[model samples]
Target: MSIGNTFYQHKDIHKKTWRHPDGRVSNEIDYVCIAKRWRSSLLDVKVHRGADVGSDHHLLIAKFRLRLKRLPPTPQRARPFDVMKLKQPTVATQFQLELRNRFQAPADCEEAEDQWTQFRTTLTKSAEAVVGR
Candidate 1:
């Protein structure tokens, strides 16, 4: 929405030649009249610069409220090529234990490397087991 710098007490006439990097806005119509017309939908309004594109106009920013209804997400049907899980399963107590006791970093470089090597081996095996390839 465009507004005369009067109410805002900020004016920059030189910005008339300025242009926004994003194409979200460009020189447009009056902002005030539009805002008052749809005061409920409009959340906020802002003014922007309009560089001379052979048109003498300033850009405007208008915010609007959008209503969306929440719906429960449904599980999508799996495709043959999809690499996700073949079956949806619940997390078990054993899985939680493995995750909690997985690994710890040591102060020494050699100890850390040993732990990291074991971790990588376990990960590779897990991936291979999942796909059964």
Candidate 2:
């Protein structure tokens, strides 16, 4: 078991992390592990013997210098109306009337994609007028 850092250079007091109740047996059981690919990012690792956490194990701290890649923000699209609102009698009637008046049936020569876009725009506009944006 390699502890991932140069543990040999550290003093005996800092090296032995856990102390037995009888104070006879002490060993370095705790460790900080990182992939070899990220070994360059790991700067230093040490055990703080002065910390009194009422535990047998000492506090181990590791310093790292890392650069995280930023991800591109996703494009926000227009949200659809709430389907539950259509269950209400007044809202249902209003929605039907607005959709019927605003949506003109696309011609035979018109593309399916263009017709779908027009339908979506008309529905969203009508829903915004009644159910709000």
Candidate 3:
């Protein structure tokens, strides 16, 4: 643990945490301690004398900033097909024939999303068979 006030600069009045009963002397006795690893997150530390808790010691305050990390997005599909194989005449013809045969089936899906999903699956399967991933 480490003291937070030592890291920041403040005036004498803002740094003092306690006052003598005679009302003529004050001292910095209270402290805001935190873990050494999280010291960078500690922004500032100060004394709040306005808070009336009926105690000789003033209220101590410590400010901090914490940052959370975001997670990476998940992949939606498998590996992609190597379309470069289609550059050859024989591979392009084979891929075209496969796609034609697969698409020949009637898509009786009522929703547009189902129709698109079926078309995408058929195209991907055909490409996988004709090309290399």
Which structure among the candidates has the greatest lDDT?
Answer: 3
Residue 81, candidate 1: how far off, in angstroms? Answer: 31
Ranking by lDDT: 3, 2, 1
| lDDT (0 to 1) per candidate | 0.47, 0.79, 0.88
Residue 63, candidate 3: Cα error in Å is: 1.1
Candidate 1 pairs with clashing backbones: 1-61, 2-31
Global lDDT of model 2: 0.79
Q: Output the number of the TM-score-best candidate.
A: 3
CA error at residue 87 for candidate 3, angstroms: 46
- Models sorted by TM-score, best on top: 3, 2, 1
Which candidate would rank higher by lDDT, 2 or 3? Answer: 3
Question: For residues 1-133, what per-residue lDDT tens digits would candidate 3 score against the true structure?
Answer: 9889767789999999999999999999999989988888999998999999999999999989976679899877877788788899999999999999888553588888888888888988898888968
- Candidate 2's clash total is 0
lDDT of 1 by residue, 1-133 (tens): 4343223323444223233457444333443544444445556555555434453455555556866669999998744322344343432333334444654444454676776887776644544444333
CA RMSD, predictions in order = 17.8, 5.6, 11.3
List ranges where model 1 is wrong by over 4 Å.
1-29, 32-38, 50-52, 69-133
Q: Which has the better TM-score: candidate 1, or candidate 2?
A: 2
